[model samples]
Target: MKILSKNLIKLRDIKTFKFKKAMINYQHVEIVNHFMKKPLILVINCGSSSLKFSLMDPKTGEESLNGIAQCLLSDNANISFKVNGEKQVLALLPPFDHNTAIVELVNFITKNNLFEQITAIGHRVVHGGEKYHQPTLITPQVKNEIAKLAKLAPLHNPANLVGIEATEKVFSHLLQVAIFDTAFHQTMPEKAYIYGLPYNLYQEHGIRRYGFHGTSHYFVTQRASSLLQKPLEQCNFISAHLGNGCSISAIVNGKSVDTSLGFTPLEGVVMGTRSGDIDPSIIFYLVEQLGYSLDQVNTLLNKESGLLGISGISNDCRTIEEQLLAGNKRAKLAIDVFCYRIAKKIASFSASLDNLDGLIFTGGIGENSNTIRSLILNQLSLLGFKANEQLNEEIRFGKQGNINDTTSRPCWVIPTNEEWVIAEQTQHLLINKGM
Candidate 1:
């Protein structure tokens, strides 16, 4: 049975909170969860410009508080947080980087006495190269290895490590685990992962497909199997995670047999900004034809392409949808190209698995946009799939609902909790050292 209810965590039942608050008011001192040894774990997803955190009970699946510190390195840095079901805004502050952002979180946790209960921390490290196949405890050596992978994922790994270092300094006594985005896709066979490039490049530079969004893809597939009441080993499906960065995964049984993302997130479906699955010659062509330098070309592929490039308006899917509704030509073009690429990849991934049991949509765009879902399903009636429009629209955010008809192949909107997946991995890998 799941530990948390569908509703918000009741604040009144929290004996610790009431007791601590009462003590603070009457006794003028902070109270800690010193009596309990069960750890209050912190799961952190450190991104380039934002830090998302959650305090979760691993065994119970109940969460205390979760929130995001966004717009880092800006004058208008903001902290948007939610405890139970209520949301609050913290004081607006100065510019902060990942390190400073994490330091502030540690301060918040400590001032509120959360640090006393925390026994460990889990981090979502973006790329693990070929070294880490599973979640491993973060040691000095492991930290160095992760640092080395900064070039492979310059946009993510470096910032991820910054959060790790800052948190380690504050919670030096706690056990910490590093969960990697590429870990779940390590099951991909060479037949599915290896590129047709020179064998020497593959051996020398570790240049091969390392699919991302592993945490989200892994958890959703397991949950889908449970929802269908089928053994995951018997389930063959394609899972799509369509946020700013989009990826499609082909799961055979319980494991990821194949996925759309390659060595970088840039090698998949057209995303919010990244040019996905582009021809290699296009990079060279842009340099010669447009008189662009390598940095200029790289910036175009990574930051100037995708929806933002097509629309010339916004990076957000919701904004694009709004523009599309208002009949903006560029917005319509951006969306058309996005869905077309996704539909094309869905077909290619389905071919990887001989038997297709279902197509699951997730992440921001995949979970919310019934329009996108309908458009994709329109081209796939041959596969006996059609999304239930009402259900798709109703349960767009954090609510679980299937979009497929009773006889149709299963399509679900299973809200993702990558933080929970990181928490689970952290717990499984660590033995309780007396807290």
Candidate 2:
């Protein structure tokens, strides 16, 4: 009996040893797999004459490197970036195009030995039209479709295509994905997207509301959902992306139901340079009565308007704020108009939501400007958004928090991270494609 009991104990010890060994082996394999796998995503946002890039870790939302190549195809072209919070600027050779800028970016990445860990490239395509509501792998056909859609976003799609083609030439071995800024708002219903114009125009010409800043809106609204400890599908909020190009979205139950910007980004609230929501007759008046050419009118509205036009100062809100403090009446008026327009838009958007979870402020102006936020919220008192003045002032310079009084509905200052959204979506597409 004693001999039999000792044998049983020996067998149990062996089994426990084997189980511990198996766990160690499994952990070792996981660690090795993590190190071997390429985990970094290169996110690119291309403007007409600039290229912005970020090396991002999708899992942790960490940006290993961030940079921009500006003034491309000009003598003054330069690439500026930060590594480990240290800023550096390098001059690009003269007459460099987007392709050249990308080549330089690749060289920099290789020099830093980050090229191998970068698994894919994510490009931000400004307008995807009615076709793409999700991130897609960049194929030849997709490129052609993006080119064909350039007429709808003449200012952005061509530039975005340039970035894609440039990256294809530079990073041919890497899988690339395109994330559209207009994709999120694709969930908006027909009533929200359709114009009061003729039905044939909507069917044939596709001349209807396709909202911009969808990427930012999606990022902020999702963050709001997380912060509120509520499921996204149950949350309703109004997200205002007040940047150089501003837009407001009404997100109901995790989807964009209506937005401020329509047909073009110029249809929304007053922006840095855009003459938003201008009367259609104004264009005719400029051409027929004022002897202005159509090209000139287009340039005037898109370039020579907004805060700059109103203040006769800078288009930057920071500068406008400084001037306002110095007793500049036009600066004051510019800010007042900007805040008032946003407030009005917020109130109007409330009608879209059955219940308001919160009001989210994101983008440059929305995140940083406490004064503007206070002004906007003060105007929204009727909607139960009484700002806690102290809380409002505390949430700035990338600090996010709820800034509303206890008696009021939540008013949050959430910083939007569009690049992270692009990175995440890019990673998701790669996984689903089994790449």
lDDT winner: 2
Q: Please, what are the lDDT tens digits per residue for candidate 2 over residues 59-169?
A: 778998999999988889999888899989998678888977887777777667676567789999998999999999999999999999899999999999999988876
Q: How much is 359 displaced in model 1, in angstroms? A: 1.5
Record all residue pairs in model 2 with backbone atoms less than 3 Å apart, i.e. clashing: none
Over 4 Å off, model 2: 1-38
TM-score of 1: 0.88
Single out the weakest 10-residue window by summed lDDT for candidate 2.
14-23
Error of 1 at 226 (Å): 0.4
Global lDDT of each candidate:
0.80, 0.87
Worst 10 residues of 1 by lDDT: 22-31
Which residue runs does candidate 1 get wrong by more than 4 Å? 1-38, 92-95, 432-435
lDDT of 2: 0.87
Q: What C-alpha RMSD separates each model from the true structure? A: 7.1, 10.7
lDDT of 1 by residue, 1-435 (tens): 121221112211333322222212211111223344556679988877888999988777678778898888888787766776988776556756666666667656655656556657999999998888898989999999999999889999998998898776555545689999999999998988899999899899989999999999998898898898999999888999999999999999878988889988889899999989878988778888989999888898989899999999988989999999999999999989998888888888766787977887889888788888888876767778887777767877677878887768888888787888888878888654222
